[model samples]
Target: MIKHAALVSFLMHLDYFDAGNMDSFVDDLTVIPAGRGTDAAGQIVVCEMEYTGVYGIADYPHVQYPVQRLLAQISAWLLDHDTDRTTPFDFSVNVETNPRDDSKADLEIRIPFREAVTASADAGGELALAGEHYDVNA
Candidate 1:
């Protein structure tokens, strides 16, 4: 299981805010369909709703949501998918930063249209997991 705490810290980095020493890093990280594909963009969209444990209801201006919140969201998002995977998933949007390995380096997600996970005779309905040859089909 990916360390929720660590992933949380990493996501925080994406926010581009100046919150000091937020803890958003992952440990024991693993990927579903393991090593599915290469880096593609515009797959995920984020709707950051809060910052520094602050959420809004009425409305605020120029609010900077904590980056870690988004990271945690991504960690949670990965948990929802099937490890074996199914069909080509077009996109995965979240307020979190994209996942990474132990070093906090980006673990490229976002497969392209063509590279998008798909069913195959050999692999069955299993979506392509990360693989050495996996390039974003898009």
Candidate 2:
């Protein structure tokens, strides 16, 4: 199964605060439908929501609402789909608050996944799981 521990480990290498890397990071780690296609396999859904003009914590609902909705969608998708649990899936978000403007913040959501493959070794020879040549003579 896709363990929480493995997901945490994958997240440790990410630097969400780096704007230059944001595009690549999001692109590489998003799993969503593409080009009017229904197949979500090998794709990630990325959502970025921004909130502005808030003056206090009490006014944070504007930001919270969209985030909550996106999270719900992601949660629902994960639950509804019968995916290969052993393959790693990334369901994570990065929230950034403006340093100069406390009222401004953004939420970045990513759900990276891979298409499941169900096959055993082909006839005549076996496939090497690690891409190394097998010692057939041995």
Candidate 3:
């Protein structure tokens, strides 16, 4: 499982937004298993995971440039930190204005990654599984 607090901290470290703004800007942060597939050798199960959240920003004049820059920065950060080269990294973003505050909008971001896991089971017995969870980009 990905820790929301840790992700928020990572974003703060990027300096795009300040600590005080975190509570207002970031929400519903989570990492979930999206799908699973076996590797070429069939020795490991590759699980596709998605890290997603809604980032709130002030909607104002000339806001497009900043939003674009923010997206680029996030993409770079993800590529630099959590990529394995063999697996493709994918991300998507959607913007929507807040109903309560037209001046505010949210950037819904989704980043996907692959994780390897080992699974085992015995007849009429319990199933045992183990996996390593990657941080941030993973």
Candidate 4:
């Protein structure tokens, strides 16, 4: 599972928008397990994970362009981080105005990742869970 703080830090590092505006732009970040699959040995070997969040952006007259650019940057980052360029990632985004604060709008995003988990033996011959590999299309 990806740590929430790590993901937030990554977003702040992106150049699509000023990092100073992050606190106002992002409301929440969550990582959840969507599904799982087993390998031939009946061991859980694959997982479907999701990163869901709401971005509360200030309602500038031209908010859409910056939001769109930010999404593009996120997509590129996901692709670059993908370990396996095979399966496709599922990404969804929705934009809407905040109910209580008309001056702020919400950019809801759901990013899905398919991860492969395997068991490997280290030099000590102890079996250990290897690192996860994201399955994403090239």
Top model number, lDDT: 4
Estimate, for each residue in 17-126, the C-alpha lDDT of model 4 and write its tens digit: 45554542223334343334444332433334343444443432234345567667766666677554363444444555443244334444444443444322234433
The order of the candidates by TM-score, greatest first, is 4, 3, 2, 1
23-81, model 2: which lDDT tens digit per residue? 32223433332222124432222222221111111122333244455346435544555
Q: What does candidate 3's lDDT look like per residue over 50-71, in tens digits?
A: 3344544443222433556767
**Per-model TM-score on C-alpha atoms:** 0.20, 0.29, 0.44, 0.44
Candidate 1 backbone overlaps, count: 30
Residue-level lDDT for 26 in candidate 1: 24
TM-score for candidate 3: 0.44
Q: Could you tell me the TM-score of candidate 2? A: 0.29
Compared with the true structure, all predictions reach lDDT values of 0.31, 0.33, 0.43, 0.45
RMSD (Å) per prediction: 15.7, 15.0, 7.9, 8.1
Clashes of 3: 0
Which of candidates 3 and 4 reaches a greater TM-score? Answer: 4
lDDT of 1 by residue, 8-104 (tens): 4444555543334343322232323422222433221111111122111111111244335544555454455323234434334323233333324
